[model samples]
Target: GLLGRYTPLDNGTDTVDEVALLELMKKTGYSMMQENGQRKYGPPPGWDGPPPPRGSEVFVGKIPRDMYEDELVPVFEKAGYIYTFRLMMEFSGENRGYAFVMYTKREMAQKAIHMLDNYEIRPGKYIGVCVSLDNCRLFVGSLPKDKNKEEIMEEMKKVTEGVVDVIVYPSATDKNRNRGFAFVEYESHKAAAMARRKLIPGNTLLWGLNIQVDWAEPEKDVDEETMQRVRVLYVRNLMLSTSEETLQEAFSCVRPGSVERVKKLTDYAFVHYRSRQDALDALRLMNGTLIDGALVTVSLAKPAAGRDGGGATWRHGGGGGGDGLFLFQRENGGVEGRRCTTPGPPGLLPAYGAQRVFPLPPGTPLSPSSLQALKPYQMSSYVSLLEHFCYQHSWSPPDYYLFSTPGPKILLIFKVVLVSTQNSYLPDKLCALVEDARELAAQHALWSLGTHTHTHTLGPRYAHTPTLTLWGQGTHTPAPTLELKFVQELSIILFD
Candidate 1:
């Protein structure tokens, strides 16, 4: 419902509750999962070789909020030529204050840590250098509020001794409080598992409230085996502009319902399928495909260690980070291997909350990554999109105004007072204006930005028709305008 409010507020223009939405999911006999950690999933039995050598992947934290891959490369290039580096992204496609850089050599990574550690990348934002670990931390949910880190640490002492520290993310809404969850770090991945393992026997309480705990690494990706207890295809190198809905639509074309869910991150995402065969099919078809002109690398994801549900330790996107629901197929009144019912609608990810939408059937869980094709339009993303279009086309600010009509779905309306100006509306010029406007709109996600709705939906390849005829018909009649579609996190919509 807050998708409307999430609309961006421009110099003129247009962005939902996360808490209220989470409560709704909880009422549905389920809770959202945790952040999906990053990984290069290997084969079914898993990669036989040792993980990347330490210092091969350097963890750089506390990065400047606006720093992107281009800017990040030079900082680490001081160490050596980098193979690639991925900034930990928020669901909104913004940087999440950290990054992982893969160097051509491990020693170069160590050199980066030494040269950049504690270096102030931005005022108040310094580079926190470390090696990417296996995320030896647990996200404790349904936690009681008002307790400081010390008290939370005290609670962890009861569960295990290998405790390192407890960190509760400050509330996005309130500064004086936390968001009711905390990360319990351990000395080792084994100790972290020991603590989370105890919680699996049943629910555990941190402060009189039943709290669910899972591996709480927000900046990493979990293997596919960690996913459905199943098979999946991992997609990476996505343009920050790509929307989850568009990703789903592209993969769904691989085969109907062949793609189940997408776990979208800052720059990459995961596509889960129903079966191993389906996963392989998706990988084979979509490993290197173009979506909105961006090339994405899709490949079979590796499976995680553990049984499904109670024994499964790995998870990704929704409910919370790094956690997904347990799937069990009952075979002749007895449960067999990990399997969920055919997916219903897409569901929302608890971690990302309102930024990305995932609609699903009753009692089913959802996560980010892909949007269901053809998402409804809102004033939020359009606010920025509209501004961008106006800026690009040089629309007369006073003569052109954009607003939204609110109903079951938000209807975005763009109105321009088109006077008979042959100077601005020459044959070739008008064609360019219309084409450029359409191109801007086309850049929108099929899930976010919409296709033509008034006429027969005009896709990119559709033949040209008069997009604006009001000026030719009569200048005094209703102004001629067009509607564009876009799906993106509201944060990206903000003009301020």
Candidate 2:
């Protein structure tokens, strides 16, 4: 006995045991072979043909006003078989007077030249057929202002009846408007050739204007390694007095191999590096540092390349200043240039001792003779009293006022002397005084509580200092740790 294997055919409406039927046919003396003794092999089970290659070139042409694919494809197919046929349609679904015919064979495409070249498809109007390569060379002009990459693809689909890859140049400031042109790529050279033949310049009208087409310039090819190595760093909030030399000197500490170039951009600078790692390292070390009392920031820079081409051009009117772009100038003798006559806080009174003295308050006045009588207390207490007076009045007393006032000023100076006589041995006495003054101001709503420092000490000596503490109304105390403990405390307070 012989074994026969069965196979089933699923034909949508029904399933049939194809192998069993074949076996029965074989048993009935039917031969499973072709007439020439050659075995015929159909397509493999469930195997569809290969996908159309992407990025193939195609040709497009403007058709005669009355001619269409029905009349067009046969003309080409009669000369040579066609791969696909299409007629471009407008948004209104009317013919746009253009069509594409893709040939199955390149030689058949060549044959179309002899048969259809200048051949009349209608009265007094000769049809045009071009090798797909010619079509690819024609540039598309007058692209719809509102069309994007997707919309371009949809419009081109009607011309080629094949996959299209379109790249559009959009305006830098307005994305919805075209930058006047676009580049379209086809999946087949035949399709590109057809496009060129049909889309004749000066002969086709799109949006009521005669459109032009030409090969777009190829994009500049930059090596991946070179691109990866090039980095842009943005440096912002620079001091107005900061010069290019100062910026360079600040970044000079970075590893020699890291930075490639540095250019100032208005209030900020662009720092480039050989690699992202170098840029990142520079950012970590340079951000938040004081440069002329202003904090500097650093980050990765953007490349100056365009979407259509890899070359970068200035987006603004003026080219960046030759290496040292000064976005602003420092005035020398104008109003802004005048020296600040404003005074420092009164707690720093000794710095202003030469200034005229002011009378104390009427409730507790001070005089030269009484100043000696109250000098026994520690210096810290005197500083604290003056700080309290300045905080209460929202004034810088020692530097701004003198013996002109006979009441509040005299009383404040007397209180300062009396407080000095009452305390001694406060280690950070001046800082404590300032802290107490700030707290009193917070309590009275003279100043917001948000200005309070966490550990009330002289601020960092650096030009740029980050927030040192959360603002609050409280007695001053030293923090044992340098970490941001107040931030955590504030978060808990907020949640509660």
Tell me the lDDT of candidate 2.
0.40
Off by over 4 Å in 1: 1-105, 108-133, 201-203, 218-496
lDDT (10s digit) by residue, model 1, range 131-248:
5544567767555667767888998898677998886644423434654667888886667767766764245555555554555533433333344445666676566677889888
C-alpha RMSD of each candidate structure in angstroms? 28.9, 32.4
- Per-residue error (Å), model 2, residue 250: 20
lDDT string for model 2 (164-274, tens) is 677664443353565445667766545664665465544554455444443332222233334455455667666546776777777756775465655564456666566
Model 1 per-residue lDDT at 127? 67
Q: Could you say which candidate leads in lDDT?
A: 1
| Each model's lDDT | 0.46, 0.40
The alpha-carbon lDDT assigned to residue 121 of candidate 2 equals 76
TM-score of 1: 0.24
Q: With candidate 1 superimposed using the best TM-score fit, by how many Å does residue 49's alpha carbon deviate from the native?
A: 24
Model 2 stretches with alpha carbons more than 4 Å out: 1-138, 161-163, 220-271, 276-496
